[model samples]
Target: MKRALVIGASQSLGSHLATRLASNGWQVVGTGRRPASEVPGSEGFAYERLDLSDPEEAHRFLEGAGSDAYDLVVHNAVTYGAIPGKPPALDELEAMFRVNALVPYRLLHGVLAAQPTDRFCSCVVVNSDSIYHATKQSAPYAATKAALRVLTTSLADTFRSAQVSVATLLLGPLPDPRKLADFQRVAERHDVPVEDVKRAFLRKANPFYVIDDLIGFDACYRSVEYLAGLGPAGNGMVCRLDGGSAGSLI
Candidate 1:
């Protein structure tokens, strides 16, 4: 029974992944701002409140947890919006950069350094295709995920000796309340039914299952398991979640 740490376990997507892993016999430790007594499939799993926005706080917390040699580390915690009220572009950029890039960039080394050489472990950095799009509502957010993608790849190079793996899960439309509500509010204000917005975001344009589906997490776990079994060093792989599940979107 290997241990796994998830930084954004409160998110629907993270919660789904954590539960799946726990059901499969992994010791799931989840961190989030609002710690639930328990979530689906995580009966006795550990839950902690973590505000990783403060990099130093995150560093200290990780250093103190003492599960340094865990089998898997998922750096999926992230802040998606611009500063409250959608601050000036520069200010928003500053905040997003820290949450999306700098913290994980440095923490990867600390977490990896804590791990042992014998186990085949990997880190998955969840990303958004917003990084590849133009004039995204949250360009800074996109930039940060892109940065993580680059960092994950570079970190893989360093893990050659320890045989650890690093990967980027370029995620698409998330089906969580946060994003769906965002769509709902905007659609309502503009005199459009929320269903229309949902259709575009998930059914046609994106055509993928949202974060709550957990299918992507299943794929993620399998990919890591496979990568870890190999002797380290493999090309980065890209996976899409919803392709034909478009009918399930609305």
Candidate 2:
């Protein structure tokens, strides 16, 4: 049986990916900020508590998780918010970078250290198109994700001969219910109608929004599965699933 570890499996796209993997007959282990009781119907897979904001705890979790020798690992955890026209505070910036950039860097190293010398492991990082197309007031979040994309690319080279592969699945918007609240909040803060927000989002220049037709959770799940299915040496390559809009990555 193929075993996989999914980082940040608590909500949004992460939660969707975890459930899909479990249903597909994979022994899936996932991480969240709290215990499994917080997740509804978590019986299909196992859970590990992880708080990426705490560096020491994150390292420990990655080390322990790596020792399990998972065939695949999917990283989908992120923390960020946007307040237009204002710079983020130092603490918030630090937290965003830690989760988006630093954690993934350490995760790769820890997993590599723990795996058997000859075993192959595939890693997929869910990345945003924000790196190529920055949105209003999302500088900190965009910068960190850009760092993660670069870091994932660099690690692929470091592990080339170790039979390990790492790939970045650059993604666009999906119809996640949770993000409705975020859209509402941003709209309220900006004192604009929600339609204005939606209009701005329809612009292919924005990183988070895609065409309405391609905005579903299933597309994201299938994209991730396809990335994980690629053979070795597919490492460092980028696969974009941003609803057919190249978003300048092409």
lDDT of 1 by residue, 1-250 (tens): 8888877777577787787778778897877776475454445567777676676677786676534667777777888764544544776677667767877777776777778777767676676666665243555666777787787777876775675777666656556767777887979888898777766665434433443332345565565455434434543444434343323535
Clashing pairs in 2: none
In model 1, the Cα lDDT at residue 87 comes to 43
Q: RMSD for each model, in Å, please? A: 5.3, 3.7
lDDT of each candidate versus the true structure: 0.66, 0.77
What lDDT does candidate 2 reach at residue 241? 77
Worst 10 residues of 2 by lDDT: 205-214
Residue-wise lDDT of candidate 2 within 1-250, one digit each (tens)? 8888888887777878888899999899888897788764467888888888788887787667757887788888887754657888888788889888998788766876576666678888888877766755777888999999889988888887776788898887665665567668879999998766755756634544446543567877887777777858567778887765554354
**How do all models score by TM-score?**
0.76, 0.85
Angstrom error of the Cα, residue 213, model 1: value is 11
True-structure lDDT of candidate 2: 0.77
C-alpha lDDT of residue 216 in model 2: 62
